[model samples]
Every structure is written in C-alpha cells, then in structure tokens.
Target: MKIAIAGAGALGSRFGFMLQQAGNDVTLIDGWKDHVEAIRRNGLNVTINDKTFNVKIPTKYPSEVTADMKMDLIIVFTKSMQLDDMLQNIQAIITDQTSILCLLNGIGHEDIIEKYASKQNIFLGNTMWTASLVGPGHTQSFGDGSISLQNLVDGHASEAKYLAACLSEAGLNAEYTDNIHYSIYRKACVNGTMNGLCTLLDADMAAVGATRMAHKIVTTIVNEFAAVAKHENIDLDTNEIIEHVESCYDPKTIGHHYPSMHQDLIKNHRYTEIDYINGAISRKGQKYGIATPYCDFLTELIHCKEDIVLKNDPVIN
Candidate 1:
C-alpha cells in the first residue's frame, strides 16, 4: 500500500515508521522542516518498549508533494486548527481512489476534510495509541492500541475493510466499526475531559483525580458534553462515560500521563484543540439552546493559557 502520514508529528511518525517496517511504501508529510530534514538524513528514530530502531521512511514537506505523487491512503494526525491547511498543502497527492483517514483528537474533523477529498473515499477512525515526540525525527511509543474505523460513504465497505487490514498488517490493531460517529464522540470525550483538565490544571490525571472535587468538576464538564451530544442524537451515557473517564485517574492505568493538550500548550507552547473539544460542545450547546457553562468556561480558560504561553514562548513548529 502506498501510504502518507500527513502532519507527521509524534503519532504520525510512529505509524509511518511501523508501516515502512512492515514493507509498505510509506511517506511522511509534515510542515516541520527540521523533522523532515532529520528523517531525510537519518531516518525516523522510533523507540518502543525501550527498543529503538531507525527506520528509513521517506519524509516530505507538504509543499514538496507533487502531482506525480499518489497515495492509496493518507492518515491525518494534524492539530485540529492545522487540518485545513495540511489538506490544502497535500491536495496534489489525493486522487479519486485516495482514502483520507482522520485520527485527530476531537470532533467535527470530517467536515473540513470533505472539501479536499470525496466523502466516499474518506474514512473516520480513532485510536487508543499514544506517542511522544522525543525530538525532531524521533518518537517514543508505549504499550498497545487499537483502531476503530468506518467509511463515510457506505458503498465502499470492501475498500474500508482493505484499509483497515493494511493498518492491521502494520501491527496497528485496526477494526472496522459500524458506528464511527459514536467512536469519534467517545474518543473526543476522553480528550475533552482528561486532556483539557490536565492542560488547565498543569497536572497529570492522578493529580486531577486526587482533588476532592474532581468528580464534581469532571461531571460538570461531561454533562455539558452529553447535553450537546444529545442534540445530535448521540445518546451518551453520562454515568458510564464518567466511570470510564475517571478510570484514567487510577495510577495503574493512565493516571501519571499528561494528555496531548498538556504536551501542546504547556510543554510545547503551542495552541491546543480546546476549541474543537469543549469549545465545540459549547458552540453546539448554544446552537441547541442548551446551557454549557462548564464547557464554555473551560474553553475560555484554555485559550487564555494558550495566549499566555504563546506570548511568553511562541512555538516555531
């Protein structure tokens, strides 16, 4: 399979390296100049379970993509805000048969991708995989993860299955899902609660859970998300979701981990996906005449932090 990992940051580099390791012809596309250069020179440094391998996969700057380049699949891992620009930059490689899969954290990403790729050729997926950027061309991944995917257009079931198989072949456990919208919402809920709170409080999941009022705060935020999701016909179980979310607080689970938003805003000094997560809920709440004070307030707080960070130490990449 000819694959492209668009927005080749931490998670992107991990998948690209693995696909290449599995003998698939994979190219990584990113806006980060240093990362592209690093991979072009020394290949992508991937360390899994403390085992490191420098897999040589071709890396390209999005602007470097030409009409001659074609891909069977393009997995998008860009930040929510950068999704549009990345799609525009890599339009040349998207042919009629090309499948664009978005594994971005948050919701409402497929709407933006539809402008660049046909709905029938698009796939929606979410993963439990985690990756950390060690440097420009290196990534550290831990444990195991699974992918849930479904075609946006129903007629392409065979094609969707093939793409899922491709991911599985690369050791990325991929499963075809019937209700990808629900999966997307489920994944977004995790980010909305854990990632946002982690970034805002400048703490890990355990620290957040340790607070006496953690359940109240978390329930407040998730209820807002649930109210908005209800308007869209997604009957999210607030209690079930709350239980699932709070499980991250266990030290044995993911309690020590700071989420992607923390990596983006707090550590990297980059803007976060707050608007896509809580902000999206807030916006939808207003649209549907629902009150979402928690989501609204969290969105503002995260943006304020992003502004403060950007003013202090702006990120270059």
Candidate 2:
C-alpha cells in the first residue's frame, strides 16, 4: 500500500512510522518547515515505551507536492482548523482510486472532505491513540489504541475492510464499524469534557478529575452533548460515556497528559478545534432548538484564550 499522512504532526508521525515498518510505502506531507527539514536530514525519532529510535521516510510540504506522487490512501491528521486548507493543497495527488481516511478529532469533517473527494472514496473514523510532539521530527507515543471506521457512502464494505486489515497489520488495532457516527459522537463526548475543562482550568486530566467539582462538571457537559447528539439522531449512552471519560483520569493512564487543545493554546500559541468540537454542538443545538449553555461558554472561553496568547506573541502578532 502506498500511503500519505497529510498532517504529519505528532499523531501523523506515529502512524507513518508504523505503516512504513509494516512494509507499506508511506510518505509524510506536512506544513511545518522545521519538522519536515529535520525528518529529511535525519530520520524521524520515535519513542515507544522508553525505547527511542529513528525511521527514515519520505516527507514533503504541501506546496512541494506534485501530481506525479500517486497515493493509494491519504490519512488526514491535520488540526480541525487546517483541514480545509490541507485538502485544497493536496488535490493534485487525489486520483479516482485514491481513498481518503480522516482520523481527525471533532465533528463535521466529512462535509469539507467531500468537496475534493467523492463520498464513496471517503472514510470517517476516530481513535483513542495519543502522541506528543517532543520536538521537530520527534514524537513519543505509548499505550494501546483502537480505530473504528466506516465508509462515508454505502456499499464500500470491501474497501473499508481492506483498509482496516492494513492498519491492523501495522499494530494499529483497527476495526470496521457500521456506525462510525456513533463512535465519533462517543469520542467527542470524551473530548468535550477532558479537552475543554482541562484547557480552561490549566490542569492535567488527573488534576481535573481529583477536584471535588469534577463529577458535576463532567455530568453537566455530558448531558449537554448527549442532548445535542440525540437531536441529531445519534444515540449516545450518557452514563457509559461519562464512565469512559472519567477512567482516563487515572494517574497511570492519560492523567498526566495535556490534551491537544491545551498544547495548541498554551504551548504553541495557536488556534484550537473548539469550533469543531463543543462549538459545533452549540451550533447544532441552536438549529435543533436545544440549548447548550455549557458548550457555548466553553467555546467562547477557548477563543478568548487564543486571543490573549496570539496577540501577546511578537511573531504571531
């Protein structure tokens, strides 16, 4: 299989290295000049379970990409805010047979992807996998994660099965699902609580979980997300989602980690995906006449943080 990782950031680097090790022809496409140059000069550095090594793989910037570079699959891991621009820049490599699998976090991504690729060639999915960008061309990942995906259009079961098998071969724990929308919503509920609250409080998952008010905050956010999901005809088990999210608070698990949103706003001084996560829910809630005050407030607060961080930065300003 010839694959291209469109974002090639933290998670994208992890997937690209694994796929390349599985004997697939994988090339990383990213916009980060320093990261791309580092990988091209030296191999990508990957640390898993305390052991670190480098893997050599091809990488290119979106502008440097040409039509001659054909791809069997393009896995999109770009930030939610960068999805549209990435798709627009990569149009030349998408052929009739090329399939696009979006593992991006958040909701409503397919609508943007379908503009460039056919619905039949698009796949929607989510993962519990986590990765950190230690530095340029370097990433650290641990623990186990599973992928659940489905075809965006009906009657593409064979294609979905093939892609799942390929990823599973690379130790990615992939599975095909008939209800990926439900899976996406379930994951969004998890992100809505951990990502939003952790960013607002400037705390790690365990810190947020340890607070006396943790349960109340989680319950309130979960209820709002559940209401919006139901209005959209996506059934979500509120209690189950809450339990799963709370389990991440264990110090042994992802409790020590700051989510991507926190990393974006605080560390990188960049924008966040709040608009696609909680903000998307708030928008839909308005359409369905369901009020989502918690989601609405969280969205506004993240944007405020972005304003403060970006405006204060000399380079960004």
Candidate 3:
C-alpha cells in the first residue's frame, strides 16, 4: 500500500516506520522543515522500549506535494485546529479512492473528513500509543499500545474491514469495532479529565493522583462527560471511566507521563483540543437540555488560559 502520514510528528513517525517495516511504501508528509530535512539527510530514528533503530522512509514537506500523487491511504495525526488547513493543503493529493484515517484526540473529525472524501474513504479510529518527539528525526515510544477502528456510517463496513486488516498486518493490532463513537467518547472523557488537570496543576500523572482534589476534580469532570454521553445514546459507564483514570494514574502504569494537552500549553501554543473534548460534551448537553456545568466551566477556563498564553507568546498561533 502507498501510504502518506500527515503531521509526521511523534505518532505519525511511529506509524510511518511501522508501515515501512512491514514492507509497504510509506511517505511522511509534514510541515516541520527541520524534521523533514533531518530525516532526508539521515533516516527516521525510532526508540521503542529502550532500543533505538532507524527506518528508511521517504519524507516530504507539505509544499512538495504534487496534485498527481495518489496514496492508498493517508493517516491524519495533526492537531484538531490544524485539520482544516491541512486538508486544504493536501487537497490536491486526495482522490475519491484514497482512504483517510484520522486518529486525532478529539471529536467531530469524521464529519470534517467526509466533507472532502466519500464515506467509504474515511475510517474512524482511535489509538492507545504514547510517543514524544525526542529530536528532529527521532521519536520515543513509551508503552505497549494498539488501535481500534470502525466505520461510522452503515454502508462503509467493507472499507473499514479492509483498513483494519491492513493496520493489523502492519503490526498496529487494529481491531474492527461496531461502535467506534462510544470508544472515542470514552477516550475523550479520559483525556478531558486528565490533560487539563495535569496542565493546570503542573504535575505528572502520579503527582496528580496524589492530590485529594485531583480525584474530586477528575471525577466531577468525568461524571459530566458520562452524563452527556448517556444523553447522546453513547454507551459510557461512569465507574469504568473512573477506573480508567485511576489505572492511568497508577505508577505501575502511565504515572510518569504528562498529558499532551498540558505539553501544548507549556509550549505556549494558542490552541488545544479541549474544545472538541469537553466543549463537545458541553454543546451536546445544551442540545439535550442536560446541564454540564463542569464541562462548561472547564472549557471556559482552558480557553481563558489559552488567551493568556497566546497574548504572552504572540508567535504560538
């Protein structure tokens, strides 16, 4: 399969390497000039479970794309805010037959992708991998991970199954899910609870759990999300959500990690996916006539923080 990984950051680099290793032709499309230049000069350096190796994959900047370049699949790993722009930039490369899988952290992206491509060409998937960019050409994967994917529309089952098989064959352990929306909301609840709290408190996963207030805040936020999910007919269990949060807090699990949203805030980026996560719940709550005070309050707080950070770092937008 001819694949192009958009964003080509930590996660994209990891996927691109895996596909190349699995004997597929992969090209990394990214806007980071330094990273692309370094990869072209050398190779993509992947560090997994304390071992480092290089994988040879062709790299291209977004500007280098040609209208005639046809890819079998394009895996999107960009931030939510970058989605529209990236789609516009890559418009020339996407054809009706190309499959586009978006593995982003927030909501509403499946519809966005469908606006450009047909329903059969879009795959909704979520992943559990955690990686961070160590350098221009290198990425470090932190833990064992897998992915689940499914078609959001009724008539796209065959496309979803084919993509799932392709991902599993490439060693991603992808599973076909019947209800991907619920799975996505489940992940979002966890991210919305942990990411902002970790950033606001300025602590690692373990440190956040050690505080008594962390439990209260996280539980409150998650409860609001769960209620919203239920109202939307999404199968989300509050107890399960709490357990998932607690499991991530365990030092034996993902204790040492910092949430990606917190990382973006620290870098003074103007945008965070909080809007798509908590804000999504809050918006749905309004429609369903259910009150999501926690989500609304948290979303407002994050946007206020974003405003402050952007004012200080004018270049972050």
Candidate 4:
C-alpha cells in the first residue's frame, strides 16, 4: 500500500517506521523542518524497550506533496489543533479512491477531515499506543497498543476492514468495529483525566495515580465525560472507562509517560488539545444542558498554563 503518515511526530513516526519495516510503501509528511531534515539526513531514530535503531523512510513537507504523489491511505496523527491546516496543505494527495484513517487524539477531527475528503473515505479510531518525541528525529516508544476503528460513513466497512487488516499485519494490533464513537469517547475520557491532570500537576501518569486524590479526580472527570457521552447517545460505562484509565497508571504500562498535552504545553510551550478533549466535552455539556464543572475547570487551567508559557517565551508568538 502507498501510505502517508501526516504529522510524523512521535506516534506518526512510530507508525510510519513499523509500516515501512513491514515492506509497505510509506512516506511521512510533517511541518517541522528540523525533524524532517533529520529524518532525511540521518534517518528516523527510534528507541523501543531500550533498543535503538534507525529506519530510513521517505518524508515530505505538506507543501512539497503534489497530486501526482497520491496515496492509497493517509493515516492522520496531527495534533487536533493542526488537523485542518494539515488537511488543507495535503489536499493535493487526497483523491476519490484515497482513504483517510485519523488516529489523532481528541474528538471532532472527522468533521474537519470530511471537508477535504469524502465522508465515505474517512475512518475514525483511537490508539492505546504511546510515544514521546525526544528530539527532532528521535522518538521513544514502548508498550503494545491496540487500534480500534470504523468507517465514518455507512457502506464503507470493507475499506475499513482492509485498512485494519493491513495495520494488524504490520503489528499495530488493529481491529475494526461498528461503534468507533464509543471507543473515541472512551479514549477521550482517558485523555481528559490523564492529559489535563498531568499537565496541571506537572507529573507523569504514575505520579498522579500515586496521589491520594487520584481516584476522586479520575472519577469526577470520567463522570462528567459519561454524562456528556450519554447525552450524545454513546453508551459509556463509567466503571469500565475508569478501570481502563486506572490500568494505565501502572508503571508497567504508560505510567512513566507524560501525556501529549503535558509535552505540548509545559515542555514545548505549544497549545494543547484541551479544546478538543475536555473543552469539547464542556461545549457538548452546555448544548445538552449538562453540567461539566470539572471539564470546564481543566479546560481553563490548561489554557491559563498556555498563556503563562507563551507570555514568558518570546520566541513563540
């Protein structure tokens, strides 16, 4: 398959490298100049379970991509805020037959993606995979993650199945489902708690889990998310979601990891996906006359942190 990994950051690089290693034709599209240059010049450096290696894969800036360079599939991993811009820049590569699998973290991405591609050609899912961008061309990935996806529009299950099979063949642990919305919401709950709280407290997942208030904080956030999910008609088991999130708190899992939001706002001084995760929930709660005080507070706190970081960093506008 001719595949392109848009956003080629941490998770993107991991997927691209794995697929490439599996003998698939894969290319990475990213906006970061240094990262792209490093990958092109020195290959992609990946560290998995303390083992390091380089994988040479083709990469391009979105602007450098042309219509002739069409892809059979485009796996989107861009940050939620960058979704629309990435789609706009990569327009030339999307065709009627091209399918887009958006495995981005957060909600409301399919809405933006549909503007550039046919609804029938879009796929939605969430991954348990975790990766960290250690530097321009280096990424640290560990733990096995599974991907759950579904067709965005009816009558396209075959395409989704094909893509899922391909990813699974490449060791991505992918599965297709009819109810990907539930999975998306479930993952959002995980992010809404871990991502936001970790950033606010400046701690990793395990540290937050170790805190005395861990259960209270996690339960409150999950409850708010469940209420909103119920309003959306997605059946979310509050207990199941909480259990899944708590499992992630184990140091054997992703406990030692700082979530993407923490890496974005605190480390890189970039804006977070709070608006898409917790902020999305808060907005939906308002629409349905549901109260989401916890989500609302987390959203505000993350934005306030962004403001503080940006204010001190003269380099970032």
By lDDT rank, best first, the candidates go 4, 2, 1, 3
Across residues 49-154, which tens digit of lDDT does each residue of candidate 2 receive?
6689899999999998899998999999999989999989999999999999999989999999999999999999999998878889998876778999999999
lDDT of 4 by residue, 219-303 (tens): 9999998998887788899999999999988898789999989888887778889999999999999999999999999999998
Q: Each model's TM-score, in the order given?
A: 0.95, 0.98, 0.93, 0.98
TM-score of 3: 0.93
Candidates 1 and 2: which is better by lDDT?
2
Worst 10 residues of 4 by lDDT: 308-317
> Clashes per prediction?
0, 0, 0, 0
Q: Which window of ten consecutive residues has the lowest lDDT sum in model 1?
A: 308-317
Residue 206 accuracy (lDDT) in model 1 = 92
Error of 2 at 317 (Å): 1.6
Can you write out model 3's per-residue Cα lDDT over 1-317, one digit (the tens) per residue? 99999889888999999888888889899887878988998889999878999877899888788887889999998888888888778878899878899899988897788777878778898898777777789988777778889876788888898898988898899888998988888788778888888777778889988897877887888888878778767867888888888788877657877777876776436378888888888898898888989889888988888887777675663
Model 1, position 193, has a per-residue lDDT of 86
The residue ranges of model 4 lying beyond 4 angstroms of the native Cα positions read none
Prediction 1 global C-alpha lDDT: 0.87
